[model samples]
Target: MEHMDSSMDIQHLLMMGMDLYRWTFHDNWSEVVEQYKNNAAIHTMPINNKEDTALHVAANNNNAVAVKQLVDEIKRTTSAVESLKKKNGKGDTALHCAASIGSLQMCMCIIEADPHQGHVLIEERNKDGETPLFLAAAKGHKKVFFYLKDCCVGESIGLCRRTSDGQTVLHCTLYRDHFELAFEIIHKYKEGIVGFVDEKGISPLHILADKPSAFESSSNFRWYNWLAYQCIYVKPLRITSHSKSQQTALRGSTADTENPASNYISEHENVVPKNYWTSYDIFMAFTRFIIWPVWEAFGLEVIKTSRKKKEKHVWCGQILDGLWKHKDVAYVGGRVKAYVMPKPGRETDGPKGDAKQSADGGSQKVTADQDKLQGDAKQSAGVGNQKVTAD
Candidate 1:
C-alpha cells in the first residue's frame, strides 16, 4: 500500500487537478458533476507538482462550489480527511490556499467539510509555519481572517505557529500595514497577542511605536483615550476647563470649595487630557515617580545633583527609555550597566532571572514607599472622616 501511494506520479496528479480546475468555470459545476460520475480518478488523485489535491486547486481558484464538492468527496471516506491535511510543496492545505487568496466562502466550505472533526484544519500551518489566520493577515484579508478567528470556537485562533523567524500573525499584520486586521487580532487575543514578542524582544507595542501611521489607519487608543489624563493626550483638554478636574484626581481638590466643576469632573469622567507630554508629564511620569523618591529609598541624596542632565522636551518613548535605562541606578554602588528590557510583560523581572534573585533586596524600598502610601492613605481617610463627622 505504501509503495502504491508513493508510486503516484506528477503526471497523474496534474491530469487529475487540471480536470477538476476546468470545471470551476461552469455556472453550476455541471462538468464536475459529470466528471465525478464518469471518472472518479479526477476527484481522488493528488497533484504531485505542489502535493496539492483537487480541492487545493479549486480553493486557489476561488470556486466555493468546487471546494465543497472536493471536501464532500473526501468526507465519504474516513482516511480522506488525512488527505485534506496533506500539504503542497509549500506545506499549505486547501484552507491555507483559500486564505492566501482571501476566499472566505472557499475556506468555509473546506473547514465545514472536515471529516476529522471541528476546525482541525483551521490551526494547520503552511510552509512558513503560519496558520491560515496568519496567511489571511499577511494578505490583508480582514474578512477572511475574522472568519477563521470565529471558527476558533472553544480555543484560541491557533496563532501558536509563528513564522520561522518567530513572528506571530500580529507581527505580520503590523508589518504588512494591515491595521484593521492587526486590530482584530489584538481585539481577539489581547493578552496573548499584544504581549507576544518575537525572538528580538519586540512586542506589538514596539511594532506600533515603529508604525505610528498604524494609528491613523485604525486607531484603538480609545481604551487609553480616557487614560490620556496620564499626560499624553490630555494636554489640550487641560488648557481649557478640565485642569481643576485633573488636579482633583491626581492630588487633592478639596481646596477649591467654591469650584464645583473640579469635584464633579473628578467624581465622573476620571483620568484627563494633554499633548503627548509636557514638563508636568516629565515630572509625573519620571521624576516624581522615580527620581525624587529614589534618593529617599536608597538614602542617596547626592544621586540627584551628581550629574547635570540635558533639559529637553522629552516625549513618552524617550521618558520610558530614560527610566528603564536608569531604573537600577538606585542599587548600592551600581555602575550604569547597559540596559535591557525584560521580556514583554516581564518588565519587573529585570535583567534576565538574575533580577529575580534580588527580589528580596527591594523590600526596604517597597516598605518605605508603602509606609509613605500608608501615611497618605491615613490623611485621605482622616479627611473623609472629617467631612462625614459633621453629619
Candidate 2:
C-alpha cells in the first residue's frame, strides 16, 4: 500500500507540473499563483523546454502585472531573489528578457523586487556575456539602455565589457545602425573602449566605414521629401520656460498695485496689436485652420520620418568625425587602412552615383565633403596613397 501511494504521489506531482507549465505559457497568472501556493516547486519548474520559470514567461510576454504578482508570491513562499534570477536555456534572467523586449515597467518591477542585489542583477550576464545594458543597446532600446545605465553608475567599464565573441555593446550598436545610441555610448564612455575589436577583427570604425548609406551623400530623398525635411521641425527635448514661482513673482512685480486690471489690460494690448487681424494675418490664420486637419491626418508622419532620417545622417557624420579625430589620441589606428580605405573592386562610388541623382544643395556638398573627409582621414592614418584590400 505504501509503495502504491508513493507512485501515485509522483504521478500527481508530474501532472501538477504540466498544468503549471500550461498556465504560465498562456499567461494565466491567476492559475499559476494558485498552483504556486499549493506547491512552491512550481516557481522553479522549467515551464517550457527552455527551462524558463513562470517569471521568465511573464517577463518575455511583457506582462508586468504578472511579474509583480509572481514576485510577490515567490517572496512569501520562496526566495524572491533566487526565483527572479532563474535562467532559461540561453541563460537569460527575467531581467534579461525584460530588457531585450524593451519593457521598462517589467525591468523596474524585477529590479525593485530584488532589494538586496539590484545592482548585481543589472550586471548579471547571460550565456553570451551580454548584460541587460548590452542587450538594451543591441535591441536599440534607448530609454531602457539609459535606465539600466543609471542602475550601473560607477561601473561603466565593467558594464561595457566585451561580451561573448569579444564584441562590445558599441560594436553591436554600430553594426545594427543604431548611430544615435552608438553616439551616446561613444560620447559617454570615452575611455577603455575606443579600440575594441571583435572576434571577426571588426572594430567600431570598420562598422562605421561599411555604412556609406548613413552619410548624406548616399541619401536618395525625393524633392518633396527634401522640402518636407526642411519645413519639419522637431521640438527640443529640454525646453526652458519660466517656473511657476518665477512667473508669479514677475506678475506681482510688474502689476500695478493700484489696480491689477490696468496692468492686465496693458499686457494684453501689448500681445494683441491694433491691426491684429490685418488682411495678411487673417488670410494666414484661416488657411492654417483649414489645412491643419488634413496635414495632421496625411502629412505629419511622413514629414516626421524624413526629419528623423535626416537627423540620423547628421549623427552618423558626427560619429565618424569624433572617432576619426580621437584616433591619434587612442589605440584605434591599428587596422585603419584595411577597413577605412576601399578595396579596388568594392562599391566605393555607390554614394557618388546616388549624389548625382539628388539635386539638393546639401547632397552636392555632402559628396565633396565625404571625399575630402575620406582623403584626409587616410592621410592622417598614414596610409599614404597605398590601399590594402581587406578579405
Candidate 3:
C-alpha cells in the first residue's frame, strides 16, 4: 500500500469492478458482489460499452438481485435512487432490454424503481422500431402480453407498437392466423381495426380470409377458422354518402365504360359477371377446394345427403328459382343462380351432422396420425431433444 501509485491503484479497482459486473451477469452474484460493495470505483465501472454503470448490465441481463444491490449502493452513497433511464450503446434502457427478452419480473422491478418508467416501458423502441409489446407478441409470450396490458392502464396501449411489415400492432394482429392474442387486443380497443390496412389494400378480414391452407396447418386451426369465419361475416359499417349528381348520372347506365356507383345495388349491377367475385370469393374458392375435396373423398354419401337436404328446403329452392329468372340482372348470372340439386334418398340431419362429424372426427384423426408420424420421424432423425420451431 505504501509503494502503490495512485493511478495504478484506481485502475486496479476499476478493472476488478468490471470483472464483478461481468460475473453478476453470469449469475454468480454472491462472490464478486462484496468487492463491488467495498470499492468506490465499482459504481463508476462501465460494462455496457456505453460507459453505463453495473446497474445497466444487471438490468440488461435481468439480474434482479444484482440490480437491488446496485440500487442500494446508489441510495446509500448518493442519498437518492439513480435514474433508471440510463441509455446503453443502442439507446435502450434496462427496461427496454428486459422487455426485449420478455422478462416480466425484471420489467416490474424497473417500473417499481420509478413508476413514471412504465410509459417508457413500451415507448422505448430498439434500433429497429420494435417495442417490447411487439417483441412479446411476435415471440408468443402470453404472460408478457398480459403484463403489458396491465401496465398500459390509464396509458395508451398503442405505445411502442410496430408491425413486422411496418403496420400498427392492430394491423399486424389482423394478419396473424392465431387470433387469441389479437382478439384480446381488439376487444380492449374496438376502434383499432378501422383503416388498419397492411401493405396491401387488404383489411384484417381480407387477410384472415386468405391462405386457408395456412390455417389448416396451424395447431390452433379450429380457433383460427372460427376467427376467420367471424372476420368474413362481420361486414364493416359504411359511413360515406355519394353526391346526388354522381348517383343519378350513373342510374341505369349499363355502358361498360361508366364508373360504378358506390351503392351495393349499383355496384352489383355494373360488375361484369366474370369479374364479380372479389378477393373474398377467391378465398372461399380455395377454402372449399381444400376442405371440400377431403370431405367428398371420404364422405361422399354424407356430402350427397347434405346437398339434397339443403336443396329440399322450399325456401332455398324458391330463392334459386327466382334468381334463375333474373339471371340477366344478377352478377355472375347463371353460375351464381345454380341451385343445390337434390339426389333421391339423399336427405338427412340438415346436413349438419355429416359436415360436423366429417370435419371434426376425420380431421382430428388425420392430424393425430400425422403428428404421431412426425414425432416418430423426428425421434429417428435424432432431433427429438430440439425445441419445436414455429414459422
Clash pairs detected, candidate 3: none
Q: How many clashes (backbone N, Cα, C below 3 Å) per candidate?
A: 8, 0, 0
Q: What does candidate 2's lDDT look like per residue over 128-227, in tens digits?
A: 7878888988998765676677666464555654455667778888888877677667765553454555545455766666676555555556676767
Candidate 3 lDDT over 1-391, as tens digits, reads 5456877887787678668757766777665556556764455556645666666677666665666666555545542223455556666666666665666555555555545545555556666556666666655444455565556545343452453343445446545533444444544443333223333233333333343322212222234333333233311212222233333343234332123434223223344465544665677688678966886788544444433322222222222222224232211111221111112123322212221121122222111232342233223222112332233
By TM-score, the better pick of 1 and 2 is 2
After superposition on all C-alphas, the RMSD of every candidate to the true structure, in Å, is 20.0, 15.3, 24.5
Regions more than 4 Å wrong, model 1: 1-44, 77-80, 157-160, 212-391
lDDT tens readout by residue for model 1, 1-391: 8777766655565665666555553444666655655554555455446656556767877766666666666666444556677777788888889988986556656766653453678767776777887787888876566666666645443353365655767667667655445544554444444444454544444454454322222222233332321233212112122232232242222232223333222221335344324455566678657766874598644333221110111122222232223234211111222222222222232233332322123222121232342233223222111321110
Residue 141, candidate 3: Cα error in Å is 2.5
What TM-score does candidate 1 get on C-alpha atoms?
Answer: 0.48
Alpha-carbon TM-score of each model against the true structure: 0.48, 0.66, 0.44
By TM-score, the better pick of 2 and 3 is: 2
Quick one: ranking by TM-score, best first? 2, 1, 3
lDDT of each: 0.49, 0.61, 0.44
Per-residue lDDT, model 1, residue 235, is: 23
